[model samples]
Target: MSQKSAPRPPKTSPDATRRSEKSRRAIYAAALELVGEVGYAKTTIEGIAARAGVGKQTIYRWWSAKADVLLEAFLDLGEQAAEQAAGPGAEYGIPDTGDLAADLKAVLRATVDELLDPRFEVPSRALAAEGVVNEELGREFVAKLLDPSLQLYVRRLRSAQDAGQVRPEVDPRIALELFVSPLAQRWLQHTGPISYAYTDTLVDYALYGLAPR
Candidate 1:
């Protein structure tokens, strides 16, 4: 009896791989640019496909919806930024030098630089504004993007508590908002200028009480 023939692997080549990578980068760039220019409400799968010079089917092959595309695009942007900041293959995390204050300052200063970067700023602002009003999008944004970063702060603060740098009773989740929320408000509301100096001051005030010892 003849054995059933083995299934052939789907065709692929180096050139095809290169083209796929190129198309993906174009889609990501187009999505970010469109969001920055027109805001999220106006950004659509068709627009992204037209801007990227790819068929909408190309996008649909990978993502089910515009939100998925935009979310993944933002994630890719963040990964690129992290690699640039920390070097290729470097894991992203807060440093736990015995000096909690110094570590916090360093992180917040980096945050200031990231916030001021136009590539990150404009598209991020668009998404942030949308998330404020779109409850479903807001939940996804928090779950996928915002909460992971916040948890990093929570982990760092917990470390500080273990080291006696923070109060044992303090909730790391809430404690983090002391520094994080103010910077967010300032940036989101355009209430004040954001700078390394400003973030450093935030670290100080969050760690130290307003009243004198």
Candidate 2:
């Protein structure tokens, strides 16, 4: 017979756990607000801790660097946004409704709404502006935040291809840019207004050819 396994650690009390979660959320809020108010280069762990009303050591105990903390904070923000949009416990991913156009439009519309939200827009714009000048930081944050969302599109497109909606010859990665890049440009440049109807049109134009098909 095998030896008994080591005993499991005792669970944290509900009150203790609640306090920990509250502190963690406060940190995230403080980080987002600070980064938005002052660009990423200027934002610091000390400032975040002060804004969060916690000691510097409190933040250090959880995250090794400001970058790590910011990344997690953004990720938490995304999950919170997703939960608000798509009920609780909803995993952030594209909907695979089998109707390619409808599925694409649905996600894009949600994205348009997100881009318009000031809480997400301000800090993200700050980070994006900084990223344009700071290539290394840009790449790091893009890999952590943006690429995961892009990958969701890639997965959804691959599913469409498997279902025979998209041509097997077409590259899903490039195909997605047709709709995604346009919306991105508009948001970043203030070139055009963003709306559900606008995104719906993009999905239609992307899936169905621009020239008469």
Candidate 3:
């Protein structure tokens, strides 16, 4: 006589994957909103769990603490913005359209829109101000979020130099910063208002050399 075998459990499908993504987005949104409402020093893991409508265990299962969750949330926000700006699978890199001026302006224009969006701006300023005094977190923020995007600009600038769009003598690292850092400082420090005209001028000044040309 043959014995009946136990049935196998059903596997998760695309719908499950999508649901999980939705849950993750909710958790990130809750974390950002909470942090913005109450400074990071008071933002607690338990608070995030409550705000996210998940059990503490659920948050613990995914993140060690509020800091880890907030750090990754910001990183995910950047990737989402990049995907939206560049389109699906287009990469987060600066566009090498052969026209340096046009490409820089295009990227910077997207940046302007992102900066103006309250969802991005409020949380970012809270984090940035904290980073100004919190050295370790500041460095981590730079390494994880800022540096990667900056590197893409550097690589594109290097390629532009090879193609004769940029002068070969220009240091791609420093050269990329000419446009990037100005906008960063303005946004972070509120040194000036951001606009298309400002970033367009940055591109022109960076490419042409501000001294004489």
Candidate 4:
């Protein structure tokens, strides 16, 4: 049996894994850069492959369309941002320090920083603009990227409601919009300056209301 044992299958080396990871990152970077530079309408699999320095077949092997590549690229960008914001191996979610107001402010402030980051700002704006005009892409963008983040706020707000910090009658999802929407509008529309101070005030207003106590 020892002499007759079938040849063992070759195992993938660490170098192979590293090379694959490197190629994947290059692809993501190429996709974001191209979209930011030329808008989504003009970005193509062939173009992305060229920019990424990979063969067209490599892209086709991983993704069926350019849309899938761009969406995954955005998701990767978000994940990297989250890791940078929270630290390595950190789980993505709103923090619950039992102080709902403080937690909201902290998360929003991080969002403010992210929005202002050049690496994130340009590509995100480009994609968001495209989503506005493209119906199917818009739905997918909301479902995959936007809604997951929104759900985190919903869960945090629901916890606040349970603890009597937020009113029981309030809807957590809609209540999140009170503060979230204003910041989003300001950033997306360039209607106003975005800052930590601005987001903090928004949280105060949403939690305590504008009228005097």
lDDT head-to-head 3 vs 4, winner? 4
Model 2 weakest 10-residue run by lDDT: 1-10
Model 4 alpha-carbon miss at residue 160, Å: 0.4
For model 2 the local lDDT of residue 160 reads 92
For model 2, how does the per-residue alpha-carbon lDDT over 87-148 read when each residue is reduced to its tens digit?
99988899987899999999999999899999999989988988899998899999999999
Best by lDDT: 4
lDDT of 1 by residue, 165-205 (tens): 99999999999998889999999999998888888888898
For model 3, give the 10-residue run with minimal summed lDDT.
2-11
Model 3 misplaced regions, further than 4 Å: 1-19
Q: TM-score of every model? A: 0.93, 0.91, 0.87, 0.93
- In candidate 1, how many Å is residue 85 off? 1.0
Arrange candidates by TM-score, descending: 1, 4, 2, 3
Model 2 Cα displacement at 92 (Å)?
A: 2.0
Full-model lDDT, candidate 4: 0.93
lDDT of 4 by residue, 1-213 (tens): 358567664577999878878989999999999999999999899999999999999899789999899999999999999999889889999999999989999999999999999999998888899888999998999999999999999999999989999989999889999999999999999999999999999999999999998
Tell me the whole-model lDDT of each prediction, alpha carbons only. 0.92, 0.92, 0.86, 0.93
- Candidate 3 on 110-152: residue-level lDDT in tens? 8999999898988888888888999988898888878888887
Candidate 4 displacement at residue 38 in angstroms: 0.4
Report the poorest 10 consecutive residues by lDDT, candidate 4. 1-10
Question: For residue 163, what is the lDDT in candidate 1?
Answer: 90
